[model samples]
Target: MFKIKHVLLLSFTIIALTIAGCKSQFEKIRLSNDVAKKYQEAMKLYNKKNYSKAIILFEDLSQKYRGRAEAEDLNYYYALTLYKLKDYTTARYQFKSFADTYPTSKYAEECRYLGAYCYYLESPKSSLDQTNTKAAIDALQLFINFYPKSERVADASKYIAALRLKLETKAFDNAKLYYDLGGFEVSNYKSAVIALKNAQIDFPDIKYAEEMDLLIVRSQYNYAKNSIEIRQEDRYNEAITYADEFMESYPQSKMLDQAKALKADSESGIEHAKRMIAEFQKNQEKYKAMLAKEAKADSTNTTIKTPIK
Candidate 1:
């Protein structure tokens, strides 16, 4: 029992001493006004990958070391520390500030690139709102334009392509949603056409270009077929025109047969409407002639009866 108690006491003393030493070292650095020692210690922590402790010291020294020869390096490291900690929003701001404040510094180009990259990292998934994705593209483009000859230009261009594709996907999906919503509470076919046309214009090189064009043809057909009889001829004629355009644009398309069928249906509809109008007019003419004959016969009979009287 005595031996066990002695060992337990020794272990507790060692733990206490270790904690005290750490506290003492932290206090010494925190209370010291020696800027050189503080700067050295901060770098030491940074190099050791103790970024959390390094950030505290760097934050304390940032304002204090302003205008000093070491200020640029200090600011660069401070921003870098934030980035390494994955505090991307703050890191982005700090990096941007570092670039603006020291445009001529050797670290300026890297800082600018990193600032834009932080936004890229923060971009949400494709299903979410793409505001951050757009911002990232804009920032990256600005970086590319500003540093056209930069070694990082290729990377910036690649990222811009990726972000633009995301926007393209979002637009395509939204337009498709309108198409799917057709024949519900409203005739959304027209809306689908408008949306798809806009998407085609906005993203001319989108991967969904072929699919969108086919959908436009389908939407126009549905819109025309659902109209009233009086308006059917004109609307169907428009559908025919769109179908013809699609054929001319993509003769080898897999949807070519479907587009042609729509054209044939529109043509048949127009012909049927014309025949109905012609038959109705012919019947009205015949009925009017018969009424004229009956009136003539009645007049003749009245004249003959009066003469006899």
Candidate 2:
């Protein structure tokens, strides 16, 4: 039993020593003044998929070899190392710089594509700011335009479509937010109508198109309902128009019943507004007649008082 225990202890010690030796060797290469040796060892580490140490060595080599012929390959490898480390933000800048500095290099096209792809990787969720998403779309489109016949054009187009869909989702959510706030301020209903319409225009093939149409109808109805009597008829007429269009477009929609109800309510509201306007005009004529009669009586009294003088 003692012999077996000693063997186990010796095995663990040997394994630990080997790991320490490997780490020391890497540190020696990192701190060494031999630029060629460092560059060779960095390539070995990268090929072995040891990015953490490879990136350190590559970064140093980039500065040591600047403006030299070796710098071109060093910069490309550095950018790739950063990408493998999942440092997309830094990777994108390095890739773009490499392409700009070495426009005639054989790797220029590849670096440009990688830079644009890095932006795609950095795109945030739909609920977050979409600046990165827009930038990604622009970068990818530029790649396609620069290399129209390249094999990567198809991939670039696909990424642009995905980014556009994300933007569409954000727009849909924003317009729906106004609708959700409609109860707090009646004017929000009008804002929702305008926003949703704009979304439809921006994303003609949007996935949420059906939902947006229904929301437009509902928003117009509520907007008309909250308007003043004099403006109600025109607003309700607009509501009816939107509802009619929704029903025609989505004949088999689950929201068809809701759209139909809005149309009926808008028609009823228009009739009510017309009746109120007629009654208001009739009362206004009566008021004017009363004022005229009072003025005539005062004039007759003034004439009689002046005749004696």
lDDT against the true structure, each candidate: 0.89, 0.94
Q: How would you encode candidate 2's per-residue C-alpha lDDT over 227-286 as one tens digit per residue? A: 888999989999999988999999999999999999999999999989999999999999
Model 1: how far residue 291 lies from native, Å? 16
TM-score of 2: 0.85
Pairs that clash in candidate 2: none
Candidate 2 structure lDDT: 0.94
What is residue 122's positional error in candidate 1, in angstroms? 1.9
Write candidate 1's Cα lDDT for 127-238 as tens digits. 7899999999989998998899999999999998988888888988898888788878336888888999999899989988888887887887777777655677887888
lDDT of 1 at 264: 95
Best by TM-score: 2
Off by over 4 Å in 2: 1-5, 248-254, 274-309
Full-model lDDT, candidate 1: 0.89
Q: Model 1, which residues run further than 4 Å from truth? A: 1-20, 265-309
Global Cα RMSD, each model = 5.1, 4.2
